[model samples]
Target: MIKSVWQGKKTFKAQSKFGHDIISDAPTESGGDDNGASPVELMLSGLAGCTGIDVTNIMKERLNDTTKFEITVDDEREDNTSRSVKYVNLIFDIEGEVDLKKLKRAIKLSVDKYCTVAHSLKATIEPKLIYNGNEEEL
Candidate 1:
């Protein structure tokens, strides 16, 4: 479970079930103290984190290289009041001697089969790959 307490000036102190605290705040323009990441940012961060973990575990089990890797999540939002998200992009930047096929399979499994956070979202997710600085497919 998660609990969020309103800190003054459009900020919230949210605690996860595991007792980790995350400070959510609005930007200065949004009448907040600019103390931490906004809720939307945190949500995106959660997606990245969930997928990252899944891929890491899968790679480890498959005996793929785990030297260097990073996941970047990006979303496109509407301009209206709701600011509804249109789609999300999960970019995987990987370096070192990793097997491309295995890496792609691991990412596909995470995005389509194992990631709870990805399954929970309502937007389309496009997964991209960059291997050793070169863009690759799926």
Candidate 2:
């Protein structure tokens, strides 16, 4: 199981079962030292990383010569009252010689099947695929 310990005010040191530790801190204005990424930021990063990992493996197997890859996670948060995330969008920027259809399929597989973080999040996430420079709907 994963564990998170309060390191100090508005700061938490999260430990993974795999032996990795990451720090989460609120902004200085919120009482933290602003030393590390906030928990929400880490959550987004984790979601991106999960999908990225799946896509990378699929690329290798398909022999896709992808030169650049980036995932952007966008969402809105309700901070004042309920303090919850509403909607989320995942934009994939992929470059190089890759089959657009296969890339889209790979992404679908990631979000729909492989990426646990994607399914674990509370908000519904829409995956947008961009191949080369054109946006494609799958």
Candidate 3:
């Protein structure tokens, strides 16, 4: 299991065999040092990263050449509750001459079928996808 020690003043050092120590914070507005992304932001970021990875990998497997995969997530909250992310909108701008059908299918599989993080977060959050380019709606 991973271990972390609180170093005081909104700084905690965590270590795992996976990689480097992670420094987390509560955000400056909430009395943190703003050292890293707040937890909620991290969650959204995880979703984006997870889906992006899956999409890229799938596209590569399909022999689709992509110039870049740009994924952005916007989080929305309700009723002023700070702990829960109510909605998340994901926008993907996939550049290149790849077939729109393949791109859409890859993204769909990532969000709806393959991505573990997306599946885990499906209940608590809503994810919307917007594709920039000629990708036809699926």
Candidate 4:
């Protein structure tokens, strides 16, 4: 379970049952102190972290260096009052000697089959690849 308490002036402190704390606040322009990540940013970060863990584990054997693996997530949100997320692009950057096919498969497995956060979202998630420096569509 998760519990959140208002921390005054558009800030909130949320604590999970696992004892992890997440500080969320609005932007200064929105009358907040602009400290910590916003709720939407946290959601996007969760998506990235979830897939990152899955992909790293799935490609453990293929990964030459664990430190070189990274995932960047960019999302677009609706402009309406709700400001719901419309779509998200997951960009994977893996450097070193790893089979592209295997890496792609791992990402697919994470986003399409494994990551619970990915499955929970209503937005469309598109995965992209960046091997070394070249960008490739996935």
lDDT of 4 by residue, 1-138 (tens): 788899999999999999999999999998999988999999999999999989889988778644577789999989999898899999998788788898899999999999989998965767678889999877
Give model 1's TM-score versus the native structure.
0.83
Q: Candidate 4, residue 131: CA error in Å? A: 52
Task: Find the candidate with the highest lDDT and give its number.
Answer: 4
* Cα lDDT of model 3 by residue, 27-50, tens digit: 778888888777677678879999
* Per-residue error (Å), model 3, residue 53: 1.2
Query: Candidate 2 — what's its lDDT?
Result: 0.86
Candidate closer to the true structure by lDDT (higher is better), 1 or 2: 1
Global CA lDDT of candidate 3, please? 0.79
Candidate 1's clash total is: 0
Sort by lDDT, best first: 4, 1, 2, 3
Q: What is the C-alpha lDDT of each candidate?
A: 0.87, 0.86, 0.79, 0.90
Per-residue error (Å), model 4, residue 118 = 0.7
Better of 3 and 4 by TM-score: 4
lDDT of 1 at 108: 97
Q: What does candidate 3 score on TM? A: 0.77
RMSD of candidates 1 onward, in order: 13.8, 13.7, 13.4, 13.7
lDDT winner between 2 and 3, please give it: 2
Point to the candidate with the largest TM-score: 4
Q: Is candidate 2 or candidate 4 better by lDDT?
A: 4
The runs of at least 3 residues in candidate 1 whose Cα sits more than 4 Å from the true structure, single-residue gaps closed, are 61-66, 123-138
